[model samples]
Target chain A: MSGVLTISQPGNSVVTDLGRFRGPRYGLPVNGALDQFSARAANILAGNEDNDPLIEITALDFRLRTDTDILVAVTGAPVTLSVGGRTCPQWEPVSVRAGETLAVRGMTGGLRAYLAVHGSVAAPVLLGSCAPDTVVGFGLKLAEGTQLEVRRSVAPIRQPYFDLPLFRLGLSRPEFGTELVVDVTDGPDIDEFGDSAGLLFSSSFTVSGRSNHIGLRLGGELPERQSSAELLSRGVPVGAVEVPSRDELLVLHRGRGVTAGYPVLAVVTSMSLDILAQARPGHTVTFRRTTVAEAAGALRTATRQLENLRAAVTTVFGLLGIGAQPQWHDLAPAVGS
Target chain B: MPVNAAAIEVHESGDSALRVVAVDADREANWTTVHRLAEWLESSGADGVYGAVPTYDSVLVEFDARSTSARQVKAFVQLGLRQLGHADTQVRAPREFDVPVVYGGEYGPDLERVAGQQGLSTEDVVRLHCAGSYVIRCLGAPAGSPMMDGPGFPLPVPRLKDPRLSVPAGAVAVAGRQAVIAPATAPGGWCVIGQTPLTLLNLANEPLVPYMPGDRLSFIPVPAADFGGYAGRYLEPAR
Candidate 1:
């Protein structure tokens, strides 16, 4: 059944899906959840469409009171999730009774946590997505006292709470730590760095506090250019490692601009992008060089894993009499321009 | 090289996108080639392709690798480019839009600074800014921010070396012969000249933005009192 959730503690959260699609034509960036793998896992566990909207809570505590019974899953970095003061398991669906309060005490591992309801978190859709993009003025923030609608096209979940946790499909979670060995492929302008091109991979950089959704500002040995010539403006893809005139090197994310003028030295791989999403400010980052073929392979593997999860979850939902099933195709995090 | 007379190159962007770049050409020719390719991809009904974003000298073709690999999309794009070269047809004219701006006040804090830099009065700065019909060259980065090109000042204006950390949204600024509007609040380095009240992007309004690349925009000076009336309204272009 459909329900309402009132945010008691927002905790820098926003509703996100695969992000706003087909936005580049209108000069909008593709902004969605920072970690695609975790978001997909949560969606699969909750038996919701892969692109359904979910709450992305960032590095803080959150609390919400519900008006009806629903199944939910918390993914992304490890966190202490609770329903009515009793701790609940993450990465798996748990039923919450009507009028019970759900809470995320704090993130124990990574920087962001995702909460996916079995029905899906409902928000106003703009263009093709309901993802909150402040820059484009699409959806608003999930602040305290905001009433959120939890919608599902199917009937209310009918499975018993005791039988739900039996089908725990194991999915490997990405390791998080103070230091990260990020994989990257060559960008279009790698040769422009001359001798400094090698330094980009060899040097250990510190993520500056100024870093945010747009990109991560790295402080370390700067990649010096061989020429003083100005680079012409061109399309800047997400994950491009740009070396601007400033001292910091930039690793663009989903929220970066559609185009830029800085020299690109490398591009983070699609699989590794999920790891970078959880990287905190002041964390040590070391670049590991890889080929485009390898990068593309990693992306393929991620999609395949999700497909397997979708298949397993489909059978489980069918057995439980739940109608909604996961459609993993086109669920991959959109490549930002 | 497959495209006759046009020097265009397509490079893989990470694993999910491909960038079509123009090689060794003037700004006009570069943009012309990129925009044509972007338009072709948008209208070609190509599957697995999401959208193409045309910038100053390139077009970023974003696609879904799951449904179709970059290799397949790249092949399709190459074939489309060859066909585009064979036809070499010009696109329809861009729509014209009049952007309402309030010059030289709180809306445009650097209007006086820009005038002083150009050795002209604030009135001259505003007059000269509104004199030329500009074209939206590209959009990106922050949000729906657009960089425009036009018959600008006689001399290129230098950017604020110590750039403002937080330039207000709708602020219109210029640098060299290029102009840009801050679609939202962010840092800016260009010399501010005026501000427009028309929202550059709002999904509530259909078509998202009234104009796209190649569209013409001319600024119409309005009193600060009238700026409020234009607020919350999308920038609708006049055909």
Candidate 2:
């Protein structure tokens, strides 16, 4: 028999609640599970595939209810997690019986968190996804009294021990004090700025409060065109820093619209989004120039590290006599070329 | 990557993907070619293609490096392009939608201001707006903000020098030669002429947004009294 697990946040959690609409809708942007990495990690701990649907909590305010014992893991945004109204350690597997309530009191710094259960949530799918599009009214934004049915799927014998992510994959450790240097490449409007435009990388910018899932408005040196040219409206890539007429730097986010006409400066690397997603409204953000080759290298290293983490978790769990599946498979499929 | 290929420019976009740009203008001329290539690769049951989002002018095809290599997908795309000269079908046909708007009242607080700036009466502004049919030029400024272009009014009205932090949803705004309706309550800088009760977006609907690129749109002057009856249907059903 299938039981239920319901989790929710107190208020709007941008990445946590914003997911793709699982209903009929073409324009609804998928806004769910911000830290895909952590979500996958939590799923692995539950002996579930990386793609298992889970609840992403922001700034605490999460409660898990069940009629049967369910294996779960909490990850992302160092939140003080409690089960049945009692404090417990996070980033590890915890089993909860029926009627147990899990709550995240608050967060240390990061803005979003992920809660994974042993089975998928019973939410309708739109565009082949179970995520919600809150802004566009697509899917369920776990409000009060949202009941999520959990299937009693076969649980893997081995479960991986969950740990926090590293600097590249997790929150920035103040000790790492390694300034978050985001690498960017030229954009369609890159040449719009004079040679001084290249100087943009040499300067620092602060994240403005106006930032949102749509885009990040950066404050600092503005890039301009050498001569005013009306750019034909075209598709904008994520991370593309667009300079609208106001001269404010609008860094496009993952959910940015398809087309735009603003003068673009550069696009941030994918690795930087992890940091960008966590950046508060007024965090210092700096851009560093990188060649196409360098960007490829960075991506390669990041992908490899992620693969290694999945492998490590698998190895650790296998040693525990639990035959947990590899976690990386949760994201992209593992098809041989 | 494959035989019968033109020059291709590649850029590393992020830690997970690379962008291969095809140099072309005349967006209309390339739509079929781009769509055909993207569709062929996706339908080929090829591995590594994870996130492939197609847009008006380009297609961003992402893949997992572990499962597929860029060179592999590039070669596959090149193979499909060799047949680009063959007969093909269109992607999505352009559609026409008539949007009803209520002008010059509590629904549109700035209607008087816009009329004053344009040297036209509030009624005259409505006449001009309804008289012209607009083309969907682009969608931007905010998500789902449709930028339509047509024969603009005789006098150019400037946008509010100050943008409202939160304009009501379904706001019908005009700036220069363009006009649009906001899909959500968002900060806007356009001159608000009125608001529409029509929901341009509904998550529960098959297509989140009712309008598409190249869709022709016309603004119908709607009465404020009839708004309440039509408002809920336009929005997604309350879950």
Candidate 3:
């Protein structure tokens, strides 16, 4: 099958072969399918491990092509999807016949969308990850004329529906005009913002357009600082909320500089990574200080739920006499019927 | 009235993560101690420590909190600080890296301005910069950028009032008392003097970034004409 996927924002979109470079050195930061859990869920529905590389579409406009029949599923953001010009339901595995093109247009639920092929798209592996970081020019972004190798062998299965947890599908119901509550863990600079900063700790913040893969530039009341001395450069982590000014909040992302000189007020917890990934620019983001114990508990619960989903998938396919083993070959194309 | 001691000083950022505060304000001693502690944790392989990150004056130790206790991790950090008190800072030599740069012209659009701001000739600026052996204070900026310390000239130049939307890769910038090399093209505010040919930050690499906080840097100047030659050299391995 032959298809074409074009990006409205060439600077905004990319089509990368799986795993081109080793780590995050592909010019841009690794900005793939933001909702990784849902990306994995799409794979599981196709009888694959959640790790397979899928089409991570930003603002949709992704198209799939194949000469033969294929099975596919859409996860993450809900989009107006069609296969050979026929409408279909989302989050369900749909199979298509040969020479059919599947197209996904503009987002309806979230900012990003993902399309998983029956057999995983063939891309080179770098540092054991197929995800592409266009910033550093590591992995490839999906683009027109980007020829990907797909396994020709088709083992078609007629599965009715996928029984995955709604949360696992990463369906986000974004509340526009409201501050997004992100859980935070205090940082070394937490105490630097004096008693008034404590007021900040208790207050909320709004995500500004300045937010990007590097970090979120937050606009809010500055946390009080006990000392005004400049800081030395140090490392930062994903989801870190660092206030460099009296009224500025910078929330770090995955590509946050290894080190920073700004005093971090708090860090966004991992439990909220999927949620943070779904956040659009200019969205209001607020912080609620959670107890360490509560944070740990939430992480454990998320991990457990992830494992349970994997187990459920295994059981369902196992009973059907299918190997059900996690394989790249099980994923279908993004444009599914 | 008895003031209840500051609440055990614990906060949450993420569900699976926790950050321990060593110092709240900017204290040179505190920052150094934090770095020393970070170095210790990285080498010790303490339980639950995913990575120890140091910023201006504090260090952030990230852990799988689920696999390890925050209290235990804090205790480990305390122990590392105590150990730093006795460790010889001079025993281990710093990592040395040589970064080549293409000075002036398009590669360094702001070089003339930077030199003029320093009240020196373009050649004098390069000479002053290359004359000294610099030490890496940190890898600030974006994930792979390096912040180094070199000899201060006549005066400490201020940062760009408004940061550039996109600073080219290998950018050699100066602000206040520090000189830094931008590994990748990201927005920056420092006064640009030249552009380096080194790709300091590559997430694809094993260590993600090649330079470290305690590393030493030597800047080698290359003519603008030779920029293409050097750029080609670095691209060889990338391809």
Q: Which one wins by TM-score: 1 or 2?
A: 1
Question: Against the true structure, what is model 3's DockQ?
Answer: 0.32
The order by descending DockQ is 1, 3, 2
Compute DockQ for each candidate against the true complex.
0.61, 0.25, 0.32
Relative to the true structure, candidate 3 reaches a TM of 0.77
Q: Report how far residue A97 has shifted in candidate 1, in Å.
A: 1.9
Best prediction by lDDT: 1
lDDT of 2 by residue, B3-53 (tens): 112534455444334444555565444444444555565566566655443
On DockQ, the leading prediction is 1
- lDDT tens per residue, model 1, B1-239: 22343577888877778888877447687787778788888889688888888888788888876677779888988887788778858677788988888987788878888788778888888888899788888776557676787436667787788889888888888887778777777787887778899887666754465667788888888999998887677777676
Candidate-wise lDDT, in order: 0.79, 0.61, 0.61
Q: How many pairs of residues collide in each model?
A: 3, 27, 69
lDDT assessment of candidate 2: 0.61
Estimate the TM-score of every prediction. Answer: 0.91, 0.76, 0.77
Q: Where in model 1 is the C-alpha error above 4 Å?
A: A153-165, A324-337, B1-6, B24-26, B223-234
lDDT of 2 at B184: 77
